[model samples]
Target: MSIDDTIGVLLVDDHPVVREGLSSILESADGITVVGQAGSGEEAIVLAGALTPDIVLLDLRMGGMDGAEATGHIMRQSPGTKVVIVTTYDSDTDILRAVEAGAAGYLLKGSSRAELIAAVHAAARGETVLTPSLAPKLFQARAKEPPPLTEREREVLQLVSRGLTNADIGRRLFISEATVKTYLMRTFKKLSVSDRTAAVITALEQGLLP
Candidate 1:
């Protein structure tokens, strides 16, 4: 059921200018297509149901439904669709929330058009991409309370840093994929991060990850 040609993108933002600008940027790029657009989370849910775009460019601070809630709904409805969050907020909480919500891409508004295109393609490919750099400053921003990831959590995290999927991790460690997910869930709770990318980013920032 998966096609490998152009990556279909949906723009979700409350601002008219932002949505149009992003569509223009994606359309100008080769191997990418703008399939749909929405100004609110409700509209996005509707369009996503109809269009089922490969990747969604979501703004975090929207009015209703919000980007995080919309992301949850979209993924639940269309398991194959990838949501890429584009916003001005890079706070750890926001980043983690988006990741937990199942967003595969995160980029600030300051990113260049080329970066946006790259992120969209990456998301379409089921890869997570974080713009600019993963630095200490980011860790400082995202880390609160900062109890740190547990020992087992850190071990599983190290494997995650090695770019292994849950199935791969299970096979490598003689554990079930369900067990790997359990570890990941615990790690998610402890680190206060939502998804794997945020976990990796936080680990990298803390020098716990290579």
Candidate 2:
């Protein structure tokens, strides 16, 4: 198909069900086609560079290489390809990091079919989409009291917002799970919040690490 006439999309997610489901959704729409699908971030980078799809629908939480890393690599390799983070996470840092990673839009997994379709269309049109619930936090990101995290604390917090479990964070950061918990506990106290969700919110507000 001609570039001007068709929107080529690549789906990057670990789950086969999600890949097929999104493929079905996009394929049924006129003027769009599922050019390829990737089950992990490494595959996504390769396919995105090779296929040069117009847009990529990426899941944030694959086991090894996550969406943010893939998005960054795609931006570097295929500058024209737009990415939309299709994630279960709505945490402020996750949304912001995807944005910083050069995603064109962020769509929660809870988004309706129409919402997903609209997001893809908008993304193809070079528009950004942040869900309504998240738009408030995104828009007011500069307005919150910043969390006072140490350098290590900040690093852990960023990964935490990406939906990484403490174990995952420990693996990524090369810290013990116990150490991860300790850092997170200190981060929570510093942020003046008591949990993972609130700490992420506080980080976004305070400009601690976006």
Candidate 3:
């Protein structure tokens, strides 16, 4: 792309040194510009909305809001902006949560300069990027084993198995009926089943229920 077509980037990291280093690296690359930096997730969301960067490099862990929550807000605030998580974490849970929160890419902080540059361009073009080490984990999380159900989901499933209606389940779980439905839906996806009856049966068959 031409210089005028440069991809705008916002770096979000809790560490000033990390943000400075990334800003320098990304700014030196062709067709990329460091538009802003933020030290926390809350600030990142605000900058993302204001700057409307082509890509936002977000840290997964921060003092408050965290990357996932910030990502969700950023996406809502600027739907056209892409979010690329650049964090020290590479766990399956971290990757899945970031993706579920609408991240366009996930790369470890240890990624090489070349990888980082490429990821920025790719993310700006709306392509997903992941470090090689993280790719397998995400794929496995999506396809290999069933997603580990959340504790809330387990409770919802057990209540469903006990012939409780959504209202009863909500009261028993001390959550709203809508929240109970949400938990059930998430459980259904995790168990790879449809409907309450199917989810309950699958959970029992897989020994996922107590």
Candidate 4:
């Protein structure tokens, strides 16, 4: 097919062999082309700007910038370019981070070539794809009960976790104690907890804390 008819893809992986393998797979697929290969997120961002691929097959873990970081940068640089994370990580945190960073799809490294091709096509068409095992995690992410706490609430809860009193947290964050208390109260209501200790515990269990 012609370049205009093909699905342009930029493969971003740290390993040369993996890139080569993925290139071969994509090359044999119909209407798909490996327009460029990047060895790091930094390079991927640069190539995405230059090549303007329709899709980016990104790896999760790289030296300088990981897939989540790369996805954010690529989407910001080229909003039309879809980012599909191809990685071995299936942890809730990893998947959630990539999704939050605006990944168009998430596929495991062990997925069949057909699945990979399908994911790339789906992503190119502005569809969301996730490994079957990851679907539950996505639901759980959305089902985070009682809604999410604001950044300020999380900061106050983190301070609570560190055994900081309201006065200390207020001083440390350059806010008045009343403001800190306000944040804490909002956090408590969101987490369905009455006290700082319970709020921190709930945040930790929900993976809202770093």
Candidate 5:
């Protein structure tokens, strides 16, 4: 690729040695350039705004503004820039947080050199990259996550928890009994329960209702 077509990358890590190693590996490849390096997430955000690099390889843990938080800032400051998290963390919480914060990729630091290069290219192409072993963890975490409940649904569930019938709930909320039933049905579906008791129990367990 021509110089203009080359991908610009910004490396963010707390350790200078880590940055140097990453730069060396990436610079050894053609069509990829390490444009800048930052010692912290705070610095990463500044350089990201200034350089507007095509990709940012970020570390999850830093002195301040951890990788997930930094990813959010970088995305807002430079919408065209793709942030790829390069971290040693592979926990479900860590991976989910980074992904939810608008990361383009999540790669473990233990990844092979070839995998790292491939992930960078994939992220620049607008693909969601995850360490091969972490994909299942991500999917399982998402599956186990409770569906978000609407305010009205929570209100209905809360009343149900108090032993209120559909009619009583409708009267309390100033809605028709049929409307209350509709809300309950919707809540049941969302909570994946077939009955009111099951729905209430599931909601309580998931903290969807107080």
Candidate 6:
């Protein structure tokens, strides 16, 4: 295809190898050009504005300004650009955040080169792309009510909100540190968050915490 007929893609990932691998795969495909590669979300935002690529393959987790946040910014800066999240995480929270942030597609890193190329092309066409297996999970997560936290889980998160360390919370509650960690893990799962701060923020937003 001609240069103008090709789909321009901007790749965003914290790891150089990941970006390089993705670029190789994408550039090898017909009608898809790897226009730029960003090693951070901040860089992705700048490139998205400057390059105005047709598609952005963004990593979900990064050191600063995660994929979801970057997707939001890219969409606002270049409304015509379609962002497709390319990450290893298939967690419901991760998927929800990306989609809610205006991502046109959610694709796992394990996807085959064909799948990745197809997703880029599809996204460039303004279609929403999602791995078939994850589509149901996304729908279910959207439809289902937020899982309620157990009383002990709530207590753990409440203590976490107070900026207490796990050991400190365990000591205050007269529980073993391992047990405190277990509660935190359960709370994180139920909250669909990977970190304590997010768990607390999600809980507060959902009125699950005071």
Regions more than 4 Å wrong, model 1: 1-4, 134-210
Pairs that collide, model 4: none
How big is the positional error of residue 169 in model 6, measured in Å on the Cα after superposition? 28
> Better model by lDDT, 3 or 6?
6
Q: In candidate 3, how many Å is residue 43 off?
A: 0.6
lDDT of 4 at 180: 95
| lDDT of each residue in 25-143, candidate 3, tens digit only | 99899999988999998899889888888899999998866887688778877999999999998888778868867899999988999999999988877788889888889977676
Task: Give the alpha-carbon lDDT of every model.
Answer: 0.81, 0.85, 0.85, 0.86, 0.88, 0.88
Query: So what's the TM-score on candidate 2?
Result: 0.68
TM-score of each: 0.64, 0.68, 0.69, 0.69, 0.69, 0.69
Off by over 4 Å in 2: 142-210
| lDDT (Cα, tens digit) per residue for candidate 5, span 105-206 | 999999999999999889888999999899998987777765688899999999999999999999999999999999999987675445788677667766
lDDT of residue 52 for candidate 6:
91
Candidate 4 error regions (>4 Å): 1-3, 145-210
List clashing residue pairs in candidate 3: none
Q: Using alpha carbons, what is the TM-score of model 6? A: 0.69
TM-score of 3: 0.69
Instruction: Give the alpha carbon lDDT tens digit for every residue of 1-210 in model 2.
Output: 355678899999999999999999889988889999999988999999899999999999897767876787799789899999998898777776678678999999899988988898899888988888999777665465445568999999999889999999999989899999999999866654456886786578667777
CA displacement after TM-score superposition, residue 28 of candidate 2 (Å): 0.4
Model 3 weakest 10-residue run by lDDT: 189-198
